[model samples]
Target: MATVTLKVEGMSCNHCKEAVEGSLKKLPGVKSAVVDLDAKTATVTYEEGAVSVDQMKKAVEDQGYDVV
Candidate 1:
C-alpha cells in the first residue's frame, strides 16, 4: 500500500472530517483515510496502482473541500 498525505483547507468540524474520509473511502483502492481537522490534512492509504493521488485530491474537492 502507498500512503499519501494531502494538505487540506476548510475543514472545521467532525462533519467535515467525516465527509472527507467518506469520500476517500469510496475510492476503489483506498484502504483507509484519516482527516485531522486541527492539522488540516488527510492521510490516505491505498493500493498504489489502483488509485492515484490526483484522484484522491479530486475526491476531497468533490466533497466541497480544497486539497492543497
Candidate 2:
C-alpha cells in the first residue's frame, strides 16, 4: 500500500475534516483516510496500483478543498 499525506486548505471545522475523509474513502482502493483539521491535511492509505495520488488530489478538490 501507498500512503499519501496531502496538504489541504480552506477547511475550518470538524465537518470539513469529515468531508475530506469521506471523499477519499469513496475512491477505489482507498484503505483508510484521516483528516486533521488542526493541520489542514489528510493522510490516505490505499492500494498502490489501484489508485493514484493525482486521483486522490482530484477527489479532495471535487469536494471543494484545495489539494496542495
Candidate 3:
C-alpha cells in the first residue's frame, strides 16, 4: 500500500470534505481517504499498482476542486 497527501483548494466546509473523501474512496484500490478542511488537503491510502497520483488528482478535479 502507498499513501499520498495532496494539497487541495476551494474546500470550505464539511460537505466539501465529505465530497472529496467520498470521491477518492470510491476509486478502485483506495483503502482510505481523509479530507481536512482546515489544512486544505486530502490524504489517501491505496494500493500502489491499483492507482496513481494523476488519477487521484483527476478525481478531485472532477469534483470541482483544485489539487495544487
Candidate 4:
C-alpha cells in the first residue's frame, strides 16, 4: 500500500469534503480517502500499482474539485 497527500482546491464545506472523499473512495485499490476542508487536502491510501496519482487526481477533478 502507498499513501499520498494531495493539495486540493475549491473545498469549503462538509459536502465538498464528502464529495472529494467519496470520489476517491470509489476508485479501485483505494483503501481510504480523507478530505480536510480547512487544510484543503486529500489524504489517500491505495494499493500501489493498482492506481496512480494521476488517476486519483482525475477522480477528484471528475467530481469538480482541483487536485493541485
Candidate 5:
C-alpha cells in the first residue's frame, strides 16, 4: 500500500473530518483514511497500483474541501 498525505483546507470541525474521511474511503482501493483537523491534512492508505494522488485530491474536493 501507498500512503498519500495531502493538506486539506476549509475543514473546521470533527464533522468536516468525517466528511473528508467518508469521501476518501469510498474510492476504489482505498484501505484507510485519517484526517487531522489541527494540521489540515489527510493521510490515506491505498493500493499502490490502484490509486493516485490526483484521485485523492478529487476525493477531498468532491466533499467540498481544497487539497493543498
Candidate 6:
C-alpha cells in the first residue's frame, strides 16, 4: 500500500470534506481517504498498483475541487 497527501483547494465546510473523502473512497484501490478542511488537504491510502495519483486528482476534480 501507498499513501499520498494532496494539497486541495476551495473546500469550505464539512460538506466539502465529505465530498472529497467520499469521491476518493469510490476509487477501486482506495483503502481510505481523509480530508482536512482547515488545512485544505486530502490524505489517501491505497493499493499502489491499483490506482494512480492522476486518477485520484481527477476524482477530486470531478467533484468540483482542485487538487494542486
The regions of model 2 sitting more than 4 angstroms off are: none
Tens digit of lDDT per residue, candidate 2, span 1-68?
88989999999998898899999999999999999888888999999999999999999999899987
Task: Write the residue-wise lDDT of candidate 5 on 1-68 in tens digits.
Answer: 88988999999999999999999999899999999999999999999878878988998998899998
Name the weakest run of 10 consecutive residues (lDDT summed) in model 3.
47-56
Model 3 over residues 1-68: C-alpha lDDT tens digits? 99999999999999999999999998999999999888899999999989899999999999999999
lDDT of each: 0.95, 0.93, 0.94, 0.93, 0.92, 0.95
My TM-score estimates for the predictions, one after another, are 0.97, 0.95, 0.97, 0.96, 0.94, 0.97
lDDT of 1 by residue, 1-68 (tens): 98989999999999999999999999999999999888999999999999999999999999999987
Worst 10-residue stretch by lDDT in candidate 6? 34-43
Candidate 3 global lDDT: 0.94
How far off is residue 61 in model 4, in Å?
A: 0.6
2 or 5, greater by lDDT: 2
lDDT over C-alpha atoms for residue 67 of model 6: 89
**Cα lDDT for residue 7, model 4?**
96
- Model 4 collision count: 0
Candidates 2 and 6 compared: the better one by TM-score is 6
Q: Point out where model 4 deviates above 4 Å.
A: none
Off by over 4 Å in 3: none
